[model samples]
Target chain A: MSMIGDIARLPAGVPETAARPQVSVATAEDYVALLKPRVMSLVVFTALVGLMAAPGPIHPVLAFTALLCIAVGAGASGALNMWYDADIDALMTRTAGRPIPRRRIAPGEALGFGITLAGFAVVVLGLLVSWLAAALLAFTILFYVVVYTMWLKRSTPQNIVIGGAAGALPPVIGWAAVTGSITLEPLLLFLIIFVWTPPHFWALALIRTEDYARAGVPMLPVVAGAAATRRQIMIYSLLLIPVGASPWLFGYAGLVYGLTALVAGALMLAFAWRVWTRTEGKAATTAARQMFIYSILYLFGLFAVLLVESIAGRVVG
Target chain B: MDNKPDPTELTEEQKRSRRSRSIAIAMVLGVLVVLFYFVTLVKGPAVLNRPL
Candidate 1:
């Protein structure tokens, strides 16, 4: 299989501003877009759950500061990703309207913004929370920008598989921020997200195979063929079922969370099963799209269950 | 930076947007500066005064 290896420069669609600079200044909204707010929201929600689930008390102000730092760190990684992927962003329909691709912001400006935010987030987290959490935050930013975006994203089909670690780290970082420690519970949460990523992403990759192919990104479907991608999704779904239930099994959560995980994991399997079994055109596309949408809901539901159960336990006990 | 100028330049609307964004950035940075001072005050110099 041919992997989309690293390119010194994008194959096509280098922005026109590269040759003759346009005096286009970015709006506040464009700067917001640079943060990829949707992705950041999910990060924030999961981190909040992690914070809430941890067995300790935290000052409300310090908790807020830690969350702010985490959110900013996630945004910084996003901005850096946009800065690096400007060429590819322009080539892909999904990303064509991004601030950089749309030429609303200069690439250099994004680079500076990202670096500054990244530094500020790390320093603030270290100062306000624990240096341990700050270090994890720094690593998450580095892993996303350097390990994933700059290296793995273009180099291999396993890019997201490995890159998923950065996303998975938020819960663990949140836990550490409050307790100044690491325990098995937060690691279990991390495992659930880590295992969940491939199936969730591969479904979308199946739908956007052509987009990845056009952008020269070696996504699973583009590189391994849709059948293999489907199989991988099923395999990961199976893995996710077990891992998602681990928290309840380990006694950190109650019956409600366990039951939620079981039902949600089964729903995810059903979606992946549809994607896997259907090999034709529109049906397969629809299945993949269903899986893509449901995956987001599944994650949110699982975390929300944990969050609610944690709060209920505290109130009742 | 691209040395060559483009035929297209910022319109009045875009220029206004730029000014607004610049101000927003400035205000945010200013808030962050104040936040840093608050954080430092909360932390205090107790750790510095501690015996090594």
Candidate 2:
């Protein structure tokens, strides 16, 4: 609160009315935007798959509690990200309309909202699930906001590579929330997302090259050029194929999931190949966009297959 | 500051909007509190067994 009060005194349109700044009433939709609901949905789904796939079954309420905690924690990270990136967010055409950049929510309000949600989620998870899960959730939020967004994003082109760990932690947290410990199974899931992040993100970064460059964010495409980025995307895609298949190879999943992984992996590689092979303007951008869109489906399909297989296994046996 | 509107001088419309926003935020907070109670109930052992 004091920090927000201090920000109010600055000339950054903090509203000179020190007693009560005239802020527009933020709508429910604005709050939802702050939560980055799209990203939160993915987090919830992946975490749910993790929870369901774990060895033991949990009470329904506790399971829902854990999922809710992870969702809130992910949202908190998004809010903090918006808070810090408000400056650059205003610069980039892609992000110029985000809540903070558009002045729909004040930076201080965002920070407070993020911190409060994060604290509440962590505490509730610890009390309801296990301290270990809560700790991982807390670390995920901190790493995403402080380490990735604040430090590496602006400093290094390898930002997503290192920062991908935060995104990868959800399943592990979910696994821990259920089992109260980490295991090889959840670690394999973690590796899949970890290896998948670069190609998935770089494909989009390829098209948003100008936006990143204008924002002064050192995305791989902006820093290393389009050709190099394309090559790296292919490399990561190749690596992803095997890792994506690991859950199947390890016997953790059945025929349905195995086939899904194989097909998804092939399509991912083929698209990345297209991205690499195409050298022209619109064609190359189109390829990258195709890869980007397919990458989302690939991940979702892979996880969906896993969830379905797990449910079938539970019912059959 | 001149930019700060006095709460007492607020028009009826402004006051109504403020009241609605306040209620919405309060409702969200209340729901969260209810959720906490449910969590505590579900994991009573964990919540109760933790050493203060």
What TM-score, over all chains together, does every model reach?
Answer: 0.88, 0.89
Candidate 2, A245-291: lDDT as tens digits: 89999999988888889989999999999999996889999999999
> Backbone clashes in each candidate structure, one number apiece?
0, 0
Clashing pairs in 2: none
Interface RMSD values, listed in order for every candidate:
8.0, 6.4
Report the lDDT tens digits of candidate 2 across residue range B5-49.
553354565456567668878987897788778877776767677
**Distance from true position, residue A17, model 1, in Å?**
17
Relative to the true structure, how large is the alpha-carbon lDDT of every model?
Answer: 0.88, 0.88
Q: What does candidate 1's lDDT look like per residue over A75-172, in tens digits?
A: 99999999999999999988999999997888988999999999999988887777899999999999999999999999999999999999999999
**Candidate 2, number of clashes:** 0
